[model samples]
Target: MTEPASARRITGAGIVLVFVYGVMALAATGRSFVQIVREFDDAPLAYGLSAAAAVVYILATLALMFSRSRAWYRIAWIAVIFELVGVLVVGTLSIVLPELFQHPTVWSLYGSGYVWIPLVLPFCGIWWLRTHRPAAVPELAAAAR
Candidate 1:
């Protein structure tokens, strides 16, 4: 079935999200690698968390790019939600539990090092996915008709 212009536009948003998350994945991976190799003993937990965040970002980006199935939608939702919670929790804990995080993370200080883009991107992704959902489902029904 031919996709409506609206669906195309929404998919474009998802593509944009893929780019954004891909960049984030690169940044987080690079930073984590540097920290892990240069100073693993300094703050294993925080650096490890940074690596984990990078993996999640990569997975979410790929899922958004390659699949528009319900599974991908669910994955995107879960990933974005987890990312939001991760940032908030890690941001707060970094202050409240400074010893556990001797160094920074993508989420540390509410993503302060990254201008809080890390904190905001997930909300955008979720919104885009929600907006695009109807286009995906209805296209199938419209095809049958």
Candidate 2:
């Protein structure tokens, strides 16, 4: 017999997505930590935004990694969507009000500091999650009925 839908969902491209998210999580965490520890005084808002981005990245990574679960799938969507909004808002603000961002954030300039991965990753994640969503269980359906 073939693997279950949940198992198949996390193979191949799914694995790649998870790996990329994991890397992004680590990178964001490290960058934010350094900024907060060393120079938060110089640009509190920018550094705080970086820290918030790092938290979002970490949440997304964990949620994606465990997305076989329905709850985790929901969390993944929330985290990824939040990340996208954060990127767009911060990127636009950084450009329109440059003085507000004396320092670059992970999301500043549409993730220019990270070569735009932060901007693009969420779209990819949404696509991946949509395509890989777990098939509804008959038990749940029957219970609901």
lDDT of every model, 2 decimals: 0.83, 0.91
lDDT of 1 by residue, 23-129 (tens): 99899999999989999898889999999889888887876765567777788778888888888899999889988777899889889899998889888877877
Backbone clash pairs in model 1 (N, Cα, C under 3 Å; residues 3+ apart or in different chains), count: 0
Q: Pick the candidate with the highest lDDT.
A: 2
For candidate 1, the lDDT comes to 0.83
Query: Lowest summed-lDDT stretch of 10 residues in model 1?
Result: 6-15
Distance from true location, Cα of 81 in model 2, Å: 0.3
Candidate 1 regions exceeding 4 Å error are 1-11, 134-145
Clashing pairs in 1: none
**C-alpha RMSD for every candidate:** 3.4, 2.1
lDDT of 2 at 94: 95
- Which candidate number maximizes TM-score? 2
Writing each residue's lDDT as its tens digit, candidate 2 over 115-137 gives 99999999999999988886687
